[model samples]
Structure formats: C-alpha cells, structure tokens
Target chain A: MSEHILETQNLTKEFKGFVAVSNVNLSVKTGHIHALIGPNGAGKSTVFNLVTRFLTATTGKILFEGRDITTTKPADIARLGMVRSFQISAVFPHMSVRENVRVALQRATGSAYHFWKSATSLNELNARADDLLEQVGLLSHADALTVELPYGRKRALELATTLALDPRLMLLDEPTQGMGHEDVGRITDLIRKVSANRTILMVEHNLSVVSRLCDRITVLQRGAVLTEGNYEQVSADPQVRAAYLGGSHAA
Target chain B: MTKIQARNRLYLLLVAIVIGLLAPLVVYPVFLMKILCFALFACAFNLLLGFTGLLSFGHAAFFGGAAYVTGHALSVWGLPFELGILAGTLAATVMGAIVGKLAIRRQGIYFAMVTLALAQLIYFLCLQAPFTGGENGQQGIPRGFALGILDLSNNTTLYYVVLVIFSLGFGLVYRVINSPFGQVLKAVRENEPRAISLGYDTDRVKLTAFIVSSALAGLAGATKAVVFQLASLTDVHWHMSGEVVLMTLLGGVGTLIGPVVGAGVVVTLQNTLSSGPLNAYVPVVLGGIFVVCVLAFRRGIVGEIKALIKQSF
Candidate 1:
C-alpha cells in the first residue's frame, strides 16, 4: 500500500444535538486525486473543514504525514503544506491577479513580514507568481483586478494561489461549483494536471466530473460514509445506487 | 524606473515638507504646529483603519494618555522635553498592547466598541490619577530644546522640530502601507479566510497594526503636549477619538494622502471657527460634515480625485 498523505480514523463532528459527520474513516494516498461526492448537507465540506482545521472534530485522530495534527491551528496546518480553496471565489477583489498570487507566495515563503522591502522588489517572488499565473492561464489578465475577472477565471486564480503554497495536499471544496460546461472542462483538466505532483482531495457534486477525475471515490450520505471504492466499484454498489446514485449505475 | 511616473512622489513630498517648514515665517507658528501634530495623529490612525481595516475607537487613550504622561514628566519631574515625550510614547505603547489584545478579539463594530469603552475607562483613570491634575490638568510644561542645543522657546526652531517629526511619522506610515506586511494586511481586509488558508495568522497581524498605530498616536500626542506646553482632559475625552475618525474619513480612509488632507481641513476649520462668532457651532458643523461625507461622498476628497484620474486614464 502506498503511504497515505492524510488519514482520519473514526472522525466525527457534532453540532449542538446533531452529528454532522459521524465515525468516518478517510485515507488519501500520496499523489492521487480522491473525490468526496455527496448530496447537499451530506457533510463532505465539513470533512474538508475538519481536516484543514477550520472546524474541529468532536472526536477522532487526523494524521498528516504520519503524525497526529487533530488540534492544530488552521494557519499552522496551512504552513505544514496543506491548503484549501474555498467553495466560492475568495480572491482579493481590489488586488490585481499578479498581486493576489504574489501575496500568497510571500505568505508561503515566510516573507510576509518583510517591512523594509517593497513587494515589487522581490524579483524571485514576482517570477514565481508570474509562473503560477501562467500555469493557471491567467498571464494575460495578471494586471486586471480580481473582481473584473469572470467567475471561471477567479476560480483559476484561487487555484494559482493554492499552488503558490507549494502544497503537499490540496483540499478543494467544490472547485467547479459555479462553472459552465466549458469552464468546468478547463478546471477539470487543470485539476488533473495539478494532481500530477500533489495529493488532491476534492468535494465534487458533479458525478460525471467525479467519475472522470477521481482515482478513488468516497460516497457520503446523511453525514456517514455510504461506500468507498474506485469509481466503477462504488457506482456499481447497490446501496450506493439506492441512496446516492438514485438507482442509476451507468458507469 | 518607469520614468519616475513624472509625478515623482518623492519630489512632491520634499516640496510639501519645504512648504511646511516655511509656514511659520508666513503664518502663525502655533497654528502650523497644531496642523503638523494633528496630521501625524491622523496618519497614525490611518495605519490601522486604512491598511488593516480595524477601526479603533479608543485612540484617544493613546493620544491623551501620552499627553498626560509627557505633561507630568515635564512639569512635575522637570524631565527634558525629548525624554518626557519618550516616556509618554512608551506609556502609550504599553497601553496599546493591552487594548489591542482585547479589542482584536472581536472584529468590525464590536472591536470599535471595545476600544471606545476601554478608552473611556482610561479617561476615568486619568480623571482620578493624582499626576493627571484632574479637570485643571497639568499645565506650564517646559518645551526644552533638542539635546539642550536648540531653543524650543524660539518659534522657528520649534516649528522645524515639529515639521521633522511630522514628516518622519508620515513617511513611516507611507512605508509601512507599501511594504509586504501591508499587502498582507490588505489581503486580510479583503478576504480573511483566504489569508488564513495561505498560512497567515491574521489576528497577530491585526494586533501588530493596532499596537503600531497606538504608539504613533501617542508619539503625536506627546509632541502636541510639548508644543502647547500643557496636557488637559480634552486629550483623553471620547470627543477627541471621534475627531480622529472624522479626519481619516473626510480625507479618504485607505488612501495615502487622504488623512493628511483631512487633518489640514479639520484643523484649519477649527482655527477659523474659533476666531469667528460661530465658534460654539464648530461641533455642529463637524457633525454635519461627517454625515454629509458618509452619505454623499463615501470616497472622500482624495478617493474621488483618484477615481477621476483613473477614469480619465
């Protein structure tokens, strides 16, 4: 078995009287694309939140790189080379695409507190940001303010920013939540290209995208894991079909 | 060098500084000092409000608290003017750390309220503190020369001193906002969750901005105490806090030159109004300006100008 980059054993989350995510086990191997697919309110995002330390798990162990990081702070978790993109676009609207990428690069490289040095003077940092922007296909729009970009481009910028962190694991919460068909296709391709190096655990609602991109699939329903396998095996499972696929097993 | 933008901001700043230095020769030295002092104060407040997006309502605590400390040191202990100001600034920095730690726990309006309430508590403390001299305040503070070489009793020397300090404070504020740390603060302001996910501890960033802002406000207040040769209850009052906010807002909350312009307008208005028969209505006029600015001109003067320039471009 390949070494798991992230593992959660008996992970659970409770909100007031209700359990949002219950007694779930998740294992994401290194350098593979794992997709968490679920219906609305199925706690897929909550699992992402728990792993990223945005929301604490009520009970469980989260092992990152073979050590327990269950109660680590979000920033610390990010610093340890795990970063997440938001469900909605979270680019700095007033800043240019280049500026947004530069900020991320500065933060990741531990130079965010370089008071005497001007941001523009950091030649290497600027170059890195430029390269990432090019990779995300935002080179032409680098000078444009983020708010001026279309929805798909903003999502691409978010990916570029996440890439700046040099993330060992990338947690994407609906990377293509609001994209049209062409945009979705572009992002799906981008994700595949990105997953060539880093481990990607994404929460995807689009079944076709999930089946297309995910190397392994985890189906979640009512805050619990329904089933888990490769796309073919999980889609063929009768319980998964009844509860999640709605009696469809075309795959 | 991008042709130095032809505007040559550095040249502009030098010209402005030269104009400021020559002001006392053409106008009243006292009035010039007041403008310079308040300009520094506004710049300090702008560091937090504009750059960090953390609006502090207890800035008067630093401004007035430093005044009280500097005044006491000058009058009672007979400390040198520079030493007294240093002591005052140190006091404010300490107060700022305490208040910043508490206020940064809550964001937006809650942070504002917590700072205001904490400042009010400091005001009460000053009112009861023996050295503060109560409502009478500490008066007749000595404005000694620089290292006992320059005579602050001379108006020109004093004006030049104030001018240099104001320029330094203004330059510091400008430098901070343009730095990488400042970019991070902007990132935090624009999208905090994104900042956090990028490995930034935003609470720490906010706290650092708050402390730096408070310390600078204290520095301005200490300078003002020496300029006026007195520290009064007016420095610590909540009204003073409101005035700083008005200055920053009227100038342009996030723009570099906005607070300075705002300070000039407010100080000039107050100076003019004080000599006129409408002196008592100054507060009403200030209140009106605030309301009008918030409603009709949300961008303020500098912001409006920048927008126009960008549109023309």
Candidate 2:
C-alpha cells in the first residue's frame, strides 16, 4: 500500500473567475488523523469538496490509494471507500435514528435498489446499526426521530452513519462545527476511536481539538497551504500564529 | 412498524374490505367506481410526491393517456379486457420512462412544471390523434369479458374487478413504501446530498419512483375508462391533474390511505353537486378546502389524525 491514502496535486477550483482553492497540493498519510485548518474564506472546505468530487476541480489530479479519481462522480466516491461528511450534521431528519445508520449500512449490502423486498427483511442490519449507535453513545436515542435529537446527539448520529461506511479515507467537514465544549470533547474522543485503522482528513475550526487529535496539521491561508507540520511545529511557527492572529480560530 | 400500528393497519384493512364489498349495494356502482379510480390515481401520485418528494403535475398524462390507449385497444382493436388494461398500463409506463427521464433532470417546482408541460403535450396529441377521436374521445369502448369468462359488461362484475385491481395496486404501493428501496427514497427526499454521499444514485431512484407512480396512475386510468365505457378529453385535462394533487394533499400527503379517502370525498362531492343548485360552487368549495388544508391542516386529514393519535397515546 502507498504511504498516502489520498493526494491532491495542484488542485484548483475557480467559481466564475473567483479562485476558491488555488493550486493546492494536499496528501493524507495512511491511518493518520490529519486536520485541515484555516480561517473563514481560506478555502479549506473548498479543498474537501474538490477532493470528494462534490465540486469539480478547475485543474488538478486527485489520487486515492494511488488511483486517479479526479473525474469520478461524487456519489461513486463513497463506493471507492472515500466518504465525506457535511459541515452540518446531515442525518435524515424524519427517519428514526436507527434507520439513519441502517441506510448507511445498506450501502455495504448494495440492497438500496431492492424496492420489491420488504424493508423489514433488512432487519439483519438492525444489530449492526445498534452497535454503531452504541459506539456513538446514541443507543438510548435509537428509536427517536433524528430531528428530535439535541444538537450534540444529532452530530453523534452523523458520526455513527459516517462510520457505518467503514471508509478507507473519511473526510469530515468541520465534524464539530456548531458543537458545545462537551460535544467537542466527546466527538474528539469519538474521532480518535474511529481513526485507529483508517485515514481521516478533517476540516476543523477548533484549534484545541486539532492539536490534541490530529497527527498532522495543514493550515490554509487565502486558499493555499500556509504551513504543514506536526501539531507542535505548526502551532509553534511564528508565521502560522501571524496568519491566525486576527482570526477567531487562533490557538 | 410497531405491533400496535400493525394491528391498527390490519383493522383498517378489514374495515376497508368490508366497505369495498358492500359499497355498491348502498352507493351508485358507477360513482363508487369513479371514486376508486381517482383514489388509486391519487395514491400513485402520492408515491412520487410524498415518498420521493417529487411533485409531478403532469400525472393526467399517464392517467388519461392510459385511458385513451385502453379505450382504443378495446373499441378499435377488440382486445380482451385484461389485455386492454395491460396495454394502457404499459403505454403509461413507457410514457413515464420518457417523461420521467426529462423531468428528473430538474427538481422542485421545475420538475413539476416539466411534467405538467409533458402532460399538456400528451393532451394536445390526444386532441388531434385519430385513435382518440378528437375532443369527443374514444367512446362506447367494450368492457369485454375478463379472463374470457367474467363478463365485465355487467356493472357489478366490473366493480369487483376494479376493486381487486385497486387493492393490488394499493397493496403493492404499500409494500414499496415499506421496502428497503423506499427507505433510501425517503432519505433522498430528506437530504439528497447526504444520500449521494451514502453511495445512492438519487437520480435513478427518483426516476424509478416516477415510473412506478406513472404505471399505477395508468392502471387507474385504464380501469376508469372501462367503468365509464368512454375515454374523453376530461380525463386528460390539466384540471384532472390538479384534482389528483388535491386528493392526495387533502387525504394526507404521506399517509397510506389519505389519497383514497380524499378521492372518495372529492368524487362524492362532485357527484352530489353535479345535479344540485350548488354545482357552480363546487370549484369554489374545493378551492376553499385546499386553502384550509394548506393553512390550518398542512398535514391533511389522515396526517392530522395520525398526529392526534400519537399525541393521545
């Protein structure tokens, strides 16, 4: 296996003459929890979107496990073991909490196309969903509507659903974006637990979480990587501090 | 589903069967059949609108287009009753595939408009088409003998057949909504981007939903033509499309029996008012009910009842 799970070379995304992500080269090492940090409008999220194929790269090549996936469709990328999470906790609001994870598990079985069969027949997946829910500490809320969950719990549900994919490279866009202090701590621990045998490329605004959890941190400034290093080196760099000096995400 | 809910559904099913069996004895058979046809149409339309979150405003094309084909097959081609209905259904399914392909390219209000435009195209085609006999439509369509034995010429026999077909269609729709595919569809409806991230081909799923809705609507249309012994311009009219939407919304957008109940009420209202002095006010009454539904009871009758029951429990 290659040292890197994913690599984006000269990735660029231009929206109507405005360059959102400019000539960015990013790589995530295998089994490493990597953090992409940047101020608002720094284009960290844009990089995530480009790598996941949610938005087409204006120019560049994205390699996953040494295979080019630059032109692949967004929906097809998940099947290739690179799954992404939305900045918002994107659970099916009307569905039961259990069903949210169950839908993700169904992706593994490829039974999402079976309309004639009873959804109950997929009861076999319920145990796995329960296990996933338990892992995210959402076992108690399994039967409740996802929409009814508190903000923190909903993010937990989103994590469970993402973990259901068992992805080789998990791309989480601001995993704990709108979370409270307790939620941030809980999700940081959850991310550490889930990242044991997988690669994680996370766009996080919280510097504390990044320093604690991420093996490597890449800071973006004005749509390009300003600095890339271990958390200690990146945080200690005077240039990195200067870039974040006036920003709200300063450490 | 919970045990209580399952039990309640069973009770509802038993009651529905009892009512279906005896409805002709009390109500006019033709009128009841009309309600049944529209009920099935609304249910099919609901499958798209409620479950898939696709608002198709051109459903009249499938419903009326199928009626025209079935009428043509039975009247001009002299096909068996079953074959004619199948012909109509297949035609509608094919039409759905074509129209759904185009409509699924857009979403939300645009999707609705595309379907509406396609249905209008079909309407114009039917108007000028020789098989449809222009505005007069294909009339005097022989009901024919079903299965070469059961004489559908008898209104009583026809009613039972229509009932059975409606039951099967409704049951199939119910099964579909409760299926794994249906769950995925609901996910798509709730959040398409999330569903795509889960590796679902949301477009394909939407198209499949559109086709299923169209086929069922066609089945209803074919049955309606045979029951009325005529396929006319009224069946294909844009107003008919609006009527099905009204029925589904009034009954309950996502509820299983909402469309059926809505259809019954609307058809009965039209029937009752057609001969009375209130005929001119029927549209106004329906419009008022729709306004009330949107403003006061956004979930429709069945949806409100469901919420009420859940609260009480």
Model 1 error, position B167 (Å): 0.6
lDDT of 1 by residue, B94-119 (tens): 99999999999898999999999999
lDDT of 2 by residue, A78-176 (tens): 989999999988999999999999999997797887888999888999999999999999999899999999998988899899899999999999988
Scanning candidate 1 chain B in windows of ten residues, the lowest lDDT window is B1-10
Report, for all candidates in order, the number of backbone clashes. Answer: 0, 0
C-alpha lDDT (0 to 100) for residue B61 of candidate 1 = 94
In candidate 1 the C-alpha lDDT for residue A171 amounts to: 96
- Interface Cα RMSD per model, in Å? 1.2, 0.8
Model 2 per-residue lDDT tens digits across residues B119-146: 9999999999888989788888998898
Q: TM-score of each candidate?
A: 0.96, 0.98
B44 Cα displacement, candidate 2 (Å): 0.2
